[model samples]
Target: MKKLINNPNHVVEEMIDGYAKAHPQHVRVLSENSRSIVTARETADGKVGVLIGGGSGHEPAFMGYVGPGMADGVAVGNIFASPPPDPILEATKAIDKGAGVIYVYGNYAGDLMNFGMAAELAELEADIQVGKVIVTDDVASAPKEEKEKRRGIAGEFFVTKVAGAASEKGYSLEDVVRVANKANDQTRTMGVGLSPCSLPQTGKPSFELEENEMEIGLGHHGEPGIEKGDLQPADQVADRLVHDILADMPLGEGEKVAVLVNGLGSTTKMELYIVFRRVEQILNEKGIQIHRSFVGDYSTSLEMGGCSVTLIKLDDELTEFVDAPADCPMYVQR
Candidate 1:
């Protein structure tokens, strides 16, 4: 359990603190709640305020997306843990303008509970109207017929990107929610785990795997997946992942889509590129058109080693929103 930190309990605080300082020009901790962060730019008048929140650990996620044309605010929790209602409320309040607020987050039990409570609190006390779009895009977490039961993973990037673009377009809260929900529906993701990550506090791997073994369809928080098997060649691994996602939602000929090859944590660019190489080849063979491609460590699970692939089916409307300009620490679109 090797980690660079003064105290395991203080990792979240220190990380957030350092993030605020490092990107002061683009973000700041809410004065009312340290756990909540808001875009440095003042909330745009009459624009739907976008608030994305969830557990901490997955950096460049819930908070890193805070900036113009992205999330207006974010409520952060402990590593792989949901934040309480208070900070969620603070985040909602910080972003809400007369146009109302939209909450974009993964479809997790804790997030649903806490965000639901915060929405009720905001309506009750501040008279702020709130809308929500919960992302459930991991295909391996559930059967195709049970997508709603799947857990959100790297696909969250596409969901947030579309939602933020809609908000920037001055869509009403209802419309923004609609757009984000549509993105979630069009998105599908699948991940494989080559190694496990240790919680800062636990100082131990959350799960164990034998040497030269891999877990397909593993969740970022170590959720069980389809199966575990001996580590295979990169192309074989990529083929299986791409095949599962395509089977769940067939892309068909000439359909355009966005591709996101994300590193879970310690996976290197070289490995990710190797995976993407196969992904591109597979898509080309299927006659699916790649509208855009993104590759990097957009979402991570502490120091875990593995990666996930996300694809978002796109139409003219979705394509425009995805290409819209956004400025954030982790995501930038010009």
Candidate 2:
């Protein structure tokens, strides 16, 4: 509630405006369409244009990845809300190259509905080919039988990175989708909620938990979690996250992985790193080397105080694309 925002209704617009101004060399925000497209300066003609879309609030997500080596366009919505079909369709049209386009977004109901509609609309009119990869990595979101039913967390980053890179490397639309789906299949995540986020419009906390309690596997919308319990130490929390995520996607001690310890807003980098140290040590004991690692706010739930850990077992091709340079205001590790 103590956010430094201008107004709830205008936050998304204002933020997008500022973002476009500060990173002109990389991207341009389409205010009318509620989307942002990467500068054609970096993406070559006849190459597949990669597009990703989702709600706002999760910074460095649907938008920040649009750059030289990442997404070509992104559709934005209100905080914690899905972008409309118009913007999604516009994004597809804006980014489509002669090769085609791939639409990669997290697995969420609203996003599914909106993006699906947009894709249908685009294919009906334009000569644009589009495919979608739904990121379902949060183990806490559903049981094994319903993994696809789970919501996406921070694992969207790896999906976008690999998928975008595949397209940038001149992969076909189907090929880009194949690699993106592979990235989704090879990833899993788990997280805990220390505090809840407030919807910009409502100006009220989405949910409330006691100071001594934490919710496991909570959705970005602050939905009820898999379980609630008394808060534990950071290491213990990390153990819960690691064991749960790794159990589903078992990591043999000698294997390798690219880890992402992400903050869901309000959770400082200090806490994220505290969790990462334990995660690193645990994976190291298992003989798993980190091919690439990121620790900071990636996808956030507005100002929720929580974190999610993502582990993607890396392969040669994936490693190469992940290492490709990406320049955005939020994730500028080129």
Candidate 3:
């Protein structure tokens, strides 16, 4: 119930204001639409536009990814709520530069509906060609056979990274969409939740867990997970998450991957690194090469206490795009 704010209803507005002010060099709120945030840098002509968005609570996502070599714009929504189609269309129009625009977002019902509506409006009103890629990377959300039904989680970072890079490289809209889908397909993520987060308006915990209990495969919005049990050591938790990911998409001994150990919100960096230590050991034992590793709060749910591990099986194209230079508020790659 403890939150720092003047009014719950105004949290989203205030947040956008503060974010734009803090990172004016990287992003700015659209003059016509308050909910749309676009890159302050000049976009190249004929380069495909990368527009990403979802709910507001998952910071550094949706908004933080908009920059020089990342997403060109974002349609920001309220906390855990899909943005209306107006802002989406606004962002789409702002980013489009004749090469067309592509929408990259998590596989959530609200986002699908809102963004879909925005795409239709863009085509009908502005004659802008728009593409879409829905990230479905949470292996725990569904069986491998039903991957399309899986929910997107921390692995969204990989999808955005690849999509933005492709767009920056002047890929056509079709090609950008193709590479984005490839990234989502190759990525897998699983999370364990130790505590719950309360919404600003509700001021009540979204879910409950016993002091010594934990839930594996929990979604960012306090969705039910696959199993609940007594808390285990960091290594055990890492093993379980990695095991499920590998099972969903088996990797060969010589295959390469990009590892992202993401904190949900309140999880400490020390704990995350400890978990990563075990993850590295496990991968090394299997002779899998880790092309790169990122550990931090890439995507988060308010103040939830948990973390997710994301691995994107990489090939040459993916490696190049992932390693490309990107500068943004929440993430930067040199």
How much is 10 displaced in model 3, in angstroms? 0.7
Write down the TM-score for model 3.
0.99
Could you tell me the TM-score of candidate 1?
A: 0.99
Residue-wise C-alpha lDDT for candidate 1, range 123-227, written one tens digit per residue: 999999999888999998888889998899999888888988999998989899998999999999999999999998988896889999999999989988889
Clashing pairs in 1: none
Q: Can you give the TM-score per candidate against the true fold? A: 0.99, 0.96, 0.99
Q: How does each model score on lDDT?
A: 0.91, 0.83, 0.93
> What RMSD does each model have against the real structure?
0.8, 1.5, 0.7
Q: Candidate 3: how large is its RMSD?
A: 0.7
lDDT of 3: 0.93
lDDT top scorer: 3
